[model samples]
Target: MFNRLRCGSGLIQETVPRFGFGPGQENLFVHKFTFSTSKRLDRDKSLIYNSQNKPLPRLDPSVVGTGNRKRAQPVIQPSEKFNYSVRKALELIYYEEESRIPTLFPAGLKLSRYLKSRTLPLEIDLVSRAVLYNTRQSKLEKIHLQRWAPVDFDKNCAFSYLVARTPAEYAVLVTIFREISRLEPNFKPRTLFDHGSGLCTGYWAANTVFGKLTEMFCVDPSTDMNDLATNIIQQGVQNVPLPKGINFRLKAPKTISLKYDLCLSAYTLMEVKGSLERLDIVHSLWERLEEGGCMVLVEQGTNAGFQIISEARDFLLRLCEADERDGIVDNEKKGEVLAPCPHNHPCPRYHHDTVPCNFSVKYSLFDIPYFSTEDVHNDLFSYIVIKKGRREGFRFPRLVEEPLKTKNNFYCRLCTGSGMLQEVMCNKKHKDLFHLSKFLHWGDEMPVHLEYTDGKEKPRPVIDRSERSMSSGEHFRDSKKEKDFKEEKDSKEEKDSKEEKDSKEEKDSIVKNGI
Candidate 1:
């Protein structure tokens, strides 16, 4: 017989009463209990058994490994060398707004006014005037006046330029030099020759990129500029001394006997009076380049600046052609365009009137009183790098415009190796290429192969390889050669027509005779 029994949560117990027959007699009872294990213990045992027996579901190989993933291509950026040097130089020179406020204020104002004048649109009167001659013949004559004059950099102007323009110039130069280094990693220049080296910005940029040079020759016509450059190199104190193997001259060397591994002429062409003078300067700089050396030319990014750079590019190319023709330079040592262009052909945008082939670099501005309040600014510049040796290796198309990204695709405007501008579209279907293209920016090289999506390639421009010459303030072709060429072509055409007519007449006679 069983009495009432109860079980607790952790343990189970049971009690039984004996002898229910006795009416008022108390019965003895026995209880039995046992401890129970928790459910967590059972779960741990099952997990261990399952883990040892069952294998993990095979992971999708593609999602489980990093080896199959594509790494991002690094973007080319402007170096901070110039910015760092500028801040350091300013510190070394003890540049303070409060100390030189009086001197800098007027100079800054003058410089601003001068720069504004330079940027003003140049106007020329083309109205013709009729003049009566004694011989009763009236002739129409047009008078043209010069609209702008070059700024003469005095001590104050030089100082102003150093404070305001040097950082931007240095940024542009460093960008260019870094590009060269990227393209030609083995290139190391021992000597540098910088013409019109305002404040020695080229020197500083080159030194930063290539490290210490064996010799640096800086030529500037402005004595004030030269002094300012030397003072800066001396760190604002005469006792500090100039850097080793660096020399500043008020004028370029008269002879080209001494050549340099690198030659630079930045913003100097715009200062010259005429195209011929700029050409002369470019020629001189080209001559100063050693064999297998590189020459860099830079100017403002304005249309005029672009024209100046284009002219220099063309002139240098022409020189290379002439040298090759005359057997002055070997095929391996001939000059070639190194940057911003994939071909030696004429520039694609050269004929375009409104558009100029220019590039911009972002740079930080130094803190100067009465100057720009912005910390960062863009320097728009037109430049060309010419190497004395033939360009080697694969040529990649350059991105001329900023890449436009859409939800599923991106567009790029590229200056191709065929010397043509092309717009290309890359979509998600391209997979990795589309992802890589997103990192590309303006003035960067597109590594992917380009093809016409419509299956029709654009025609290349036809440039006449005629014997051209630069003349007095103009570019001209020899009239005799043009006349002879035209005559020869006309004669060939006439002869071909006559022969065809004779053959047709013969056929007609034979038909009549047969009839």
Candidate 2:
């Protein structure tokens, strides 16, 4: 069915990661590979394999060799022209049952045959053309799709070519934007610079929410993707219900000298030329922002600040340990013990688990528009706003007591204890979990209390008990229950402490006695 391009595929099947070079560029190619699970073969099934070695059924001519019976090629290249063979292939797949379509190659051949006379070297070119057309026609429906805007949607094209490729980045961008919007309304930015704008998703997002004349600049190193992105943006601008005023420029970062009000880098920093080189690039881009300008960065967000590190770890754990390369494993004697990826894929000799991680570390080091002025160690994807210079005094926004019931449980972020909460309680009871300033100082409303840590000389004042609001409760029964709970917790702590102390003493005695 996928052979026909008439079969409709869901986001799960359609969203494979495809890679390509620029148009008209030599070595330009796109690869589509799908990965799915298969049930174990029933070796005991007597009919499945004859002990005497019976030959399998002959290949169906309609399925395999019929494509050789090519009709007359149209004058125009099927891929070059907007209509004709590509459309036919698309209709074929879009109309078929999801289960009937077996592989993308069949659908690819149908269009490739129509365009084979065009002399294009790669079959992927036709596929790319076909999928690009599909994306333009398909509307993203999920909130993550809407939020990530152009980038996630753009990567959705990759779905046809890649395995385990799911672009959920849009949700992150939208969450940050929505939070910032709700936090500071008057701080609407007028100009934005996206450092590594793969497919210009941020531009679409900005256009979707702000709708003002926000000058947008998209930068990327890949010439072909940049071209595709440029086309996508143009297409979006021409058709998308955009706000009345908006200007867009797709150019290299080095060329753009105009200072912007905001800058964003989504999944681009990790793919930069090098580490120090990427740092320089970020600095150069940062300089092109006016005072009070902010920068937003998004990436894979891993432990080591480099992309290769995370990729290596993921490969070792996922592919090496599993000993399964899907279908892309290289079987010929290449001196390597195991095929790195699935059988015939075009990635390096490794299993790719994620985009790189450079966007996380270096971006956090620099000062941007406004947020924290201290050293930041972000674990997962982080939201940062760096301001240029000191401005007028400002009042902090009131902390919203976020209700646990309202938050999505899909994502849970991590950080070392030194960074923030050690084991942050994101449970429904802790609604205001992220409001850092709430527990800062003891005040009139809060009671002064003393708490002690082990190996300390004296007890420390963790909280002032007198300032606690529940201290003045009029109901004796409720107050008694509260006091009893506290006492029970204290008793448990004492018992644990005694056990620890006794264990330590016993160890010391044993050592002294030379056990």
Question: Highest lDDT among the candidates is held by which one?
Answer: 1
Per-residue lDDT for 1-515 in model 2, tens only?
Answer: 00111235521222112221222321221122311111111111111111121111111223322232222211111112112222233344323322333443254334322221111122234435545544544343221121111222232233221111111243345444554454346557878788766545566556445555347666665454454444433432333443333443445545546788777776665444334555555566656767555555555433222233323223323442233355433322111111111112222211211222122111121111121324322223423333443322222211111111113221111111111111112233433332221332110011111122333444333433346533335457776888999999999999999999999999999999996
For 30-107, candidate 1 gives per-residue lDDT tens digits of 111211111111111001111111111111223223332334422222235444444455566646633564676567
TM-score of candidate 2 relative to the true fold: 0.36
Alpha-carbon RMSD to native, per candidate: 35.5, 26.2
List candidate 2 stretches off by more than 4 Å: 1-167, 234-257, 305-380, 390-515
Report lDDT (CA) for all predictions. Answer: 0.67, 0.35
Q: Write down the TM-score of every candidate.
A: 0.65, 0.36
Query: How far is 67's C-alpha from truth in model 2 (Å)?
Result: 62
Evaluated against the true structure, the overall lDDT of model 2 is 0.35
